[model samples]
Target chain A: MPPLKSAATPVASVLAADARHTVTVVLNGTPRTGQAHPRLLLSDFLRHELGAHGTRVGCEHGVCGACTVRIDGVAQRACLTLAVQADGRRIDTVEGLSQSNQGPTEGRMTALQEAFRRHHALQCGFCTAGILMSLSDYLGRNPKPTEEELRDMLSGHLCRCTGYAGIVRAVMDVTGQAAACDTRSGEAAHV
Target chain B: MKPASFDYLRPATVADALAALAAGGDDARVIAGGQSLMPMLNMRLVQPRLLIDLSRLEELRTLKADSGWLSVGAAVTQAELLSRPTLRDEVPLLAAALPWVGHFQTRNRGTVCGSVAHADPSAEMPLCLVATGGAVVLRNAKRRRTVAAADFFVGPLTTVKAADEIVESVRFPLAAAGSGHAFREVSMRHGDFAITACAATVDGTQASLAVGGVADRPTLRSWPLVGGALLSDLDAALNAFAWDLGGDDDQHATARYRRDLVRRIGRTVLEEALSCRR
Candidate 1:
């Protein structure tokens, strides 16, 4: 039998005594890797370490959906996750959604953005990023959710100012006119 | 608040993880998704010297069905379980109970094994597993053993899992065709922790009930089927168990209030389960 390896590595010693660790993650269509502490929260790493501030943090306890991001193509809360946990994984923040200058190109946010603008979905703007990420993820799985399904899906998110009426309208408008949106480029973006 | 510093190790195998835990001694902790553990760490409730990451172990991420049982790996995330088509048909109770575990975001990283290992009395996974008579497989460097759900939980936030052992998987027996399972909980908010949770499963003449959150460990009661008259007996049994188990008072609800709620919820869940058979 092979000799048994030592399993007694102390996490405190590693974390407290400054043992450097590196993690690789694909963020926003680009492969990015960095060195970080094991205790580093993914939300903090994105906003402070990597300067990707589009992923906002609200009610870090996982109640509010303001810290939502896509991890491995599924919407996840960044604030509640450790950066090291996302190592070797694919992550997409709100910044990956669309480009202002891209002009409805592939994977662009033309229709959803237009719907939000048309329905006045956002107010205060603090909760927009998280809502957008969640909505985008939902629409990808269910392109045409009924009003009840949309309401249930949006239950995880909070929009204190808009009261969800505008957001629901925006989702319905975008989904109801999905064919027209599909004719344009970037409407087929999943995850 | 910043989490207290801790060493991180991503072990490629379960043996390595167990060795790391043994070596780190009491200061070493196993972390899967860090969804629950991270919050506890941030709150300064636990400060382990080492964090053994189990994410690298591919063996712990599988969901397999055998002849009589379906086994779910410890590191299998809630999102994975929710999406797995097998679980929907094999264990409908788990499927129904999972969405209430947290939210889509938390579920993305939270693992079923991690939740069960944490042994939060009010947690959905533990209650559902116990109700279904699930078995937990714990492995160490030298040996591995399986503990039944009835014997796994010893107290709140505590289990039979040894410090040097890692939870490998949980096995749930497949329900018979006429079987039915139901889970319900009452919480202050939609996504908050449950003040009281109940799960019941009925298969023909046999019935099993497991109640969590209102007790230190999941309280389970099983008996042969009887008609409406037996409900009062079950309610009495629950009321007596509630007082006997010391589930009456906590930050969420008073001891007296909890006892009342448990009796009410237990009867309701049992009645619901019985109705499905007829």
Candidate 2:
């Protein structure tokens, strides 16, 4: 084992602890600017500073997927990201999903969202925004994913209600796969 | 949970980052992907006086395979590594273990070297590193050094890394011809930390098994099959190794159950590796 060095050497200047930095990001197809303390998370920055409430914050840690959003077109946890880290980046939240390329129609829901409504994928709706953001990004890349792959992707999120069966059906329907639903029995169909 | 106030710096180059570390010493912390560190920060587990962000440093994003090793740079995310076309061929153990590191959402942001820097007991990255006989590159303002993965981790969430140093990259030995590797873990949830993880690498002459989440650090034991060993001897060696790991009863599993996993999953991975060998 190499000898562990102690922290005795001294060198240069550091930013003040209370200093706030100006962060600018292209959020939801618009340039948004805000001032944030270095300690502020991107989740809070989006919700409080930028007024993008579609990106919810849950489990301030990375466990719950409610804070998941698209950074540079890739889905990632906003809670795990710092506001300054997302400076000068493009961020797409659930609000932007409705505005995506859906044949030139404004405020039109994506196929995934329509399926979610048809299959009753959301209840209480606390985790819906994050799940929609993740799935919308995912189903775009992997348009036709196996049930196992979709389930593996869904494992990242935690939803108290719905038991994830409706979410599975919704995704299956959007991907052009036949999904059986038994609403009368209130039982989850085999995914 | 919210993180305590701290000064944040995004250095454009590694030199500036090292300078910031040298100045702040232990009070400054380097953050790459922040998958593990952010949770700690939000929970106030680690509140540094300064936070240095390395996401913008382009030089630290190298991921290349050469010289019989797949060298992953500090800024290489787990998703980036998994997306590498040659990852499965160059480093099969890592390719097998990367999916189990975190969920797809977190993996999109979690760096490969960041996991090694965190050095969690049940983390799949360190276990794969030790199992494949890899190395970790450490850099500071003044010097650079390489340490074997087996010697890099001393305990859970603890490594030989110094306060003024950063993990420059990690090098995983490429899979040799006629060699095969496999990884398996038993976690409470799909994206949760493993209760017990097993990784195995085998070739014509030697068979090695590494187990994590059951000890202070990932431990590896090898058996030589040059002339061929008896089945009973192999079983006895595995059983002894499982006991030696000293599984602790935790919220997720009992000590006995962990040991059982070590013995069972350990053998299952070894058998899978042996059968996959070309």
Candidate 3:
């Protein structure tokens, strides 16, 4: 790969305005230090500063779960957390499940990902990472979740696609529980 | 949207936090879970000059079950309280209300006292605090005082907290033996803020009723426990009910509908609590 040619020259004042806080964090097992504005959001810091673009942000007011990430092994809303608040802490974003390992499947695609694939749980792929991260933290504590309980767990996420059928099935299949229904919605069923 | 530039101060002690607040004057805000405050900051609704993070104040992180009450420190997260069996036992109203605070993730970082201090009129913790007759412990450099939850909130998102004072903890008195607690709320979505909610604790012939989202702050009423109140003319009671919190039309619900819902949930929770006592 070669660097793309660009005619735009970089400006310095914008960079100067952002040099307010020196935040150090352990992100996905790596120690990184950078300068950010005191109010830079954790989601923006991950995407812009560390280039972890997999951590998506949809609703910034903390309603949608698209900006979910793990901090100290706890799933949290990146949009609701400030970068300086994350200083001296550990964070895990969707980049942790990126294709980093040599395998037939997506690199670092944990069991939940495989289950999602098996059930055709995702379509637009926008909320996939956040949902996976949210459930990864949730399922660790609730391995034998019931269908009603799993639906309650999934309520935290807002999916405009799939109608949540496959997502529920994937969770049930992974947990060896029975699905409550067989109907799929909107997107063509791939499974 | 991101927050505006501000200094972040992680104070080592409550005293230091108070000093920072005093020095920073009216432009300083405290951050605990940052769940509520961070959202406000992101919306650019609030821009403080300094943020006093109370995450490291060990003295404010205590959760002790005393003889007749439970005191939760300012730094204790909502999830922490939900995880404690004793809180679920002694202050059962809090346990019933904690899950409704927000999603599991928000609860993981949102502080119990912070929620009370943030003072959302429709929030579950404030309703519980008021319904159960809880108290918010306030402290400044000069003195410390405890204010009842009923007297704490001046209006929506407003409280009696001064510039130099910090909400150290919230104390919830234990429910009487054989008392039954019930919580009910109607929201568009499962984890969203309530349209109207009710909390009640009934013991024998006594009952405490508190309703939120129908008023500016949680509207509370205490009276003798009436048998078969759920089966009685709930509509009549709600029709004549005064929403002291000042109900008004909003995007989520109409003022008339909110008042109607208050009566419905109020009757349901009060009846359920009474039945449980039996």
Reference-based TM-score of each model: 0.87, 0.94, 0.89
As for TM-score, the candidate ahead, 1 or 2, is 2
Ranking by TM-score: 2, 3, 1
lDDT of 2 by residue, B37-114 (tens): 999999999999999988767889999988988999999999999989898889888888988989999999999899
DockQ-based CAPRI category assigned to the predicted complex of candidate 3 = acceptable
The collision pairs in model 3 are B216-B245
Model 2: how far residue B98 lies from native, Å: 1.0
Candidate ordering by lDDT (highest first)? 2, 3, 1
- Writing each residue's lDDT as its tens digit, candidate 3 over B1-278 gives 77887877766567777877888899988888888888898888998888787875778899998887799999999988998977667888888888888888788788999999988988999999899889999998778999999899888899999988889999999877788899989998888899988998887666667988877888787666456244355556555664544689999999878877877777788878887763
Instruction: Give candidate 3 misplaced runs (Cα > 4 Å).
Output: A1-18, A98-108, A179-191, B226-238, B242-246
lDDT of 2 at A146: 92
Tell me the spans in candidate 1 whose CA falls farther than 4 Å from its real position: A1-20, A100-110, A146-152, A177-191, B227-245
Please give the clash total of every predicted structure, in order: 11, 0, 1
Q: Cα deviation in Å at residue B222, candidate 3?
A: 1.5
**Predictions in order: lDDT:** 0.78, 0.88, 0.80
Fraction of native Cα contacts reproduced by each candidate: 0.45, 0.74, 0.46
The residue-level lDDT of candidate 2 at B151 comes to 96
Task: Supply candidate 1's per-residue lDDT for B164.
Answer: 86
Predicted candidate 3 versus true structure: per-residue lDDT over A1-191, tens digit per residue: 12111101111111222366666777777777777786788899889988889999998878788999998788889998877667767788777765434466546677667778767789898998889888878888889888787877677788999889888888887787754333343243456
DockQ rank, highest first? Answer: 2, 1, 3
